[model samples]
Target: MMSKLLKNRYLILRRIVQITILALYFGANAYGWKVLVGNLSYSKFLQAIPLADPFTVLQMLAAGAVVGVDVLVGAVVIAVFYGLIGGRAFCSWVCPINMVTDLANWLRRKLKIDRDARRINISRRFRYWALGTLLVVSFVVGAAAYEFVNPIGFFVRGLLFSIGFGWTLILAIFLFDLLILKHGWCGYICPVGATYSLIGSKSLIRVEHNHLNCTNCGNCKEVCPEKQVLNPVIYRKSGFINGIECTNCGRCIEVCNDNALKFSIRSFLKNN
Candidate 1:
């Protein structure tokens, strides 16, 4: 178990970050800590700084609503963050829904189910389409239409407030990951993730593959949730993992016993 934990060091670190952030929200609510309050869409930190999701802000704009300065500042802060790191990093490191999907994926493997057989056919553009549709709906309805169905919001509310249809939405996601698709929610359908990916498509920081040390053992691929993002970087002499799909979760680096992969700036990537 110790050896296994060491090998999955990044994965463990991701869980800790995700749990800690959520715990702080609960802390604010249940204990009146007030360090951080509100959901992912909006948050107040230390009763001073406000944080808001850019996508949510866009929805509000489409609805022709007023955005406060604090909310705008918070959105910029988040944008700068995901812009520097990878945007999809939010999916792997911050979103609470990732834990549910990941758990279903793990259980699917443990049950000896053939993943390829259960996986459904879906275009990657579905997320972009979903994103466009959401904006249109928000414009038409003069409200954040997608917020009504967003599972991330549901998960946070369900956790801190009361259980309602949120549990059903979450359970449906778990079943979808296990029975219909390998990465159905975040990969193919999440508008929030799609929006962030666009924001960080040219992120400076990325995982660099040390082609000199690689043995093509394929452990990295086996552990990677976004396998296609690694293909060019690993095999085709690409500069870095340039795809917006990459979350910088570092699972590839973690499972590589040979130290063939590590985080570095895109400019520092070695050519084959």
Candidate 2:
């Protein structure tokens, strides 16, 4: 067990962080912790500071800037956090839906399901279209209308309130990932993910591939939710993963037997 853990430290750490975040919200709701309130869309910290999704704020700005001061500040704080750390981290390390999707992926593999054979042939460009649609709908409705159908909202509300309808949506996501698509929601569909990727385009921390030790074994690609980002970087065609969509989830790092991949400031890696 100790040997297995030492090899997969980052994966274990990410799981812990995800669980703790959910637990905090549940505690605040059930026991009045008051340290953090609200879900991923908009949240209060210490009952004073704010942390919010910048994309949601963007929709609010588009519709009308008739929002609260705390909301704006919260969006900025979140933007900075993602900008420094890389945005897709939000998808893998923070989003509650990730837990469901990951489990689906694991189960699909275990059951010997053909991931590519079952997926719908939807354009990956749809995420951008969906992002645009979300903003337009918000502008038309004068509110963050997407939140009503947002799985993230459903997941959080289910945790705080009752599973009710949310469990249905959650189960659908699990099934979608398990049987219909591999990495369907986050990689191909989510507007929140698209927005965060845009915000973290020039993030400081990123995955750096040292081609010297790389073996071209493709273990990293097998595990990556965003494998497209790894090919250029790992093959030495690019200095590092430049794609904004790279989530910095560190799965590639943990699975790399050659120890060629690592997390570092993008500039430092390039300079050396």
Candidate 3:
């Protein structure tokens, strides 16, 4: 039953759309395409009539020109599409690097060597602290700091530089993902994930567990990539959400045989 639902047409379509967008993004970045369809650029083109490259927006935003039309437009698009639809849906399903990470995770699971289940003793509070530090650094040192830690940027650079030269460091991260980690870069590191997680907290769409129907079967916890759903702080709803680490990948929902979870949207103003 779980497998059938996981293989549902909607999920398959979602995955296809995500992969298509990610491929276009990679092509635009690597091949210097003037126009790409079904991506942020396409939407930007429709809005502005003369599409601005993402690099230009990145530069202007980095220089503290946040009030410009370009910045505003970009922010709205990112927030509405990526943040509101599903947190890090872009990262989980639409990122080329994330595709690679998923592939690695699959191999690790097949090998029975996955270590992502190991509980780290690090304070959950540290995620918030790290988020704060990234925001401050982005303001102070600029997007360069954020870019350095962004998996998207890292993957693009790795593809360009490391793939050609066969760099050991790049290969190591790839191998680490395949051997010891399950979306490790995403769950533990990836500043872009951190950024998206923050933006997505107040997003309209969110996952809700129907505790009344829940059997406490722990299936959701077992398959959750973020593993936060298992934490009492979040599971018990000690707060709106315990942390911003959730990617909203829907794997938990897919794994729950009891159909105890669902994603629904809420108005930000009304909820607040």
Please provide, for model 1 over 53-74, each residue's C-alpha lDDT reduced to its tens digit, 9 standing for 90 to 100. 8899889888998978988898
Q: Per-residue lDDT of 153-220 in model 3, one digit per residue for the tens?
A: 45555543444443454566567666555556667665556666776766666666666667777777
TM-score of each: 0.93, 0.93, 0.69
Model 2 backbone overlap count: 0
Query: Alpha carbon lDDT of residue 75, candidate 1?
Result: 88
List residue ranges in candidate 1 displaced over 4 A. 115-119, 268-272
All models, RMSD in angstroms: 2.3, 2.1, 5.1
For candidate 2, write residues 1-272 as lDDT tens digits. Answer: 99689777887888898888888888899999887888888888889989998887888887776889899899999898888666568888898898888899878878878735654777766788999998999889888877778899899878989767678888998988888888888888989999888888777788878888888898988888877777667766435677788888888888889878888787633432
Which of candidates 1 and 3 is the stronger one according to TM-score? 1
Candidate 3: misplaced stretches above 4 Å? 1-11, 26-72, 83-85, 114-143, 154-170, 180-182, 233-243, 267-272
Residue 201 of model 3: what lDDT? Answer: 66
lDDT of 3: 0.57
User: lDDT for each of the candidates?
Assistant: 0.83, 0.83, 0.57
Clash pairs (backbone) in predicted model 2? none
